[model samples]
Target: GQQVMQIPQYQHVQEGEDFTTYCNSSTTLSNIQWYKQRPGGHPVFLIQLVKSGEVKKQKRLTFQFGEAKKNSSLHITATQTTDVGTYFCAGSTGGFKTIFGAGTRLFVKA
Candidate 1:
């Protein structure tokens, strides 16, 4: 069976600080997707990396894919109160049944 795991089940950061979360899978992943869910909000797609050693960035956020395709990471340069949410990683083996990781919950303090 395929499984996706994440680190730091919970994190608390002060405004203007930095935060990082990691994700790993037990099997080779065909593709991986990152999502973020705000407090009392639904999960929204952030980005997806399918190629090995790929790096993508969006403003203050960055995403990296492991060269082996079994791990990934998300980093936020400067934390903000609006950044409070849960980050999740999902893996797909080329079809349905994508496995979602247990998400890293973040709490940003004012």
Candidate 2:
């Protein structure tokens, strides 16, 4: 069975600071989907990375895939209060079944 693991379970950052979360899978991942879930809200798709060594960015957020295709990371530049949420990484093996990580909850102090 394939499994995805996310690091730091939780993170607390001051507004204007930087934040990052890591993800790793037991098997090579065909694609990784990132999502953000706010308090009492559903998870919203953030972005997806497919190619090994791929990097994508949205505003102050950056996503990266490892060359080994088994790891990923998300970094946010100058964290803001709006960034407070639980970030999840979902690893898919050729679009069959996607395994979601435990997610890293981020708390931003304004």
Provide backbone clash counts, one per model.
0, 0
Q: Write the per-residue lDDT of candidate 1 for residues 45-107, one digit (tens) a residue.
A: 999999999999999999999999999999999898988999999999789888999999999
- Candidate 1 clashes between residue pairs 3 or more apart in a chain or in different chains: none
lDDT of 1 at 27: 93
> Mind giving the per-residue lDDT tens digits that candidate 2 earns over 1-110?
88899999999999999999999999999999999999999999999999999999999999999999999999999999999999999999896788999999999999
| Model 1 spans > 4 angstroms off | none
| TM-score of candidate 1 relative to the true fold | 0.97
TM per candidate:
0.97, 0.98
Model 1: lDDT equals: 0.94
Residue 92 displacement in candidate 2 (angstroms): 0.5
RMSD values for the candidates in order, in angstroms, are: 0.7, 0.6
Give the worst 10-residue stretch by lDDT in candidate 2: 90-99
